[model samples]
Target: MGDLAAVVAARGVPAQEVMDEYARTLDRLVDPVRHPSLCWLRESGRLGTPDEPDHDFRFGLERVLDGVEALARGASA
Candidate 1:
């Protein structure tokens, strides 16, 4: 995976631009295979709305912490 800003290893490319590039790459990778079914909730971006109470929170925090722990343990070994 490529990190934002300063390149993976140069020139003066901004971090946000690199991130946007990555997001577009991810979007291309997961292109929709078929159109929405007859019974589907139609919306933009994602299923949950950002304005909703539960929409924004620590959903990915635990997963990220676990990944860091795994990397730490691997380094120790």
Candidate 2:
């Protein structure tokens, strides 16, 4: 992910935008239903079950977006 971010940065994407997109991509990839191992891990307690797995992922993505938004605002300031 860091390598991908570096490549995007090299291509001239704004740093915050790169991070935001990366986080969004991760949100999509982290869907437990899409990955059987993740489901198994969650069921087996290896990953521990969230009250709402999807919501947890969305919350994390929102936090990441918020951080990126904060950085963008700071840059503009």
Candidate 3:
């Protein structure tokens, strides 16, 4: 993910745009058919259970992107 961020940054993409794409990619990865073991791990709590049921991907990705956005804001400030 870091490598992806670096590449996107090099291309002059806005931070929020990069984060949005990252979030979408993460969402895609959470598909059970595409990543059964990852889905299993999330469901089994190996990836840490989220407060909202069946929202592990959306919740986690939002939290991560939020943090990244905050950091970008702070840096710009």
The 0-to-1 C-alpha lDDT of every candidate, in the order given, reads 0.48, 0.61, 0.63
**Candidate 3 structure lDDT:** 0.63
TM-score of candidate 2 relative to the true fold: 0.34
Query: Which digits, one per residue and each the tens of the lDDT, describe model 3 over residues 1-77?
Result: 45445556698876556556655565566788978887776556433311333355676799999999999999999
Off by over 4 Å in 1: 5-9, 31-77
Tens-place lDDT per residue, model 1, 26-73, is 555553555353113322433322222332334567778889999999
Return the candidate ranking by lDDT, descending: 3, 2, 1
In model 2, the runs with Cα more than 4 Å from the true position are: 1-50
Candidate 3 colliding pairs: none
RMSD of 1: 11.0
What is the C-alpha local distance difference test score of candidate 1? 0.48
**What are the per-model numbers of colliding residue pairs?**
0, 0, 0
- RMSD, one per candidate, in order: 11.0, 15.5, 14.7
Mark the 10 consecutive residues where model 3 has the least summed lDDT: 45-54
C-alpha RMSD of candidate 2: 15.5
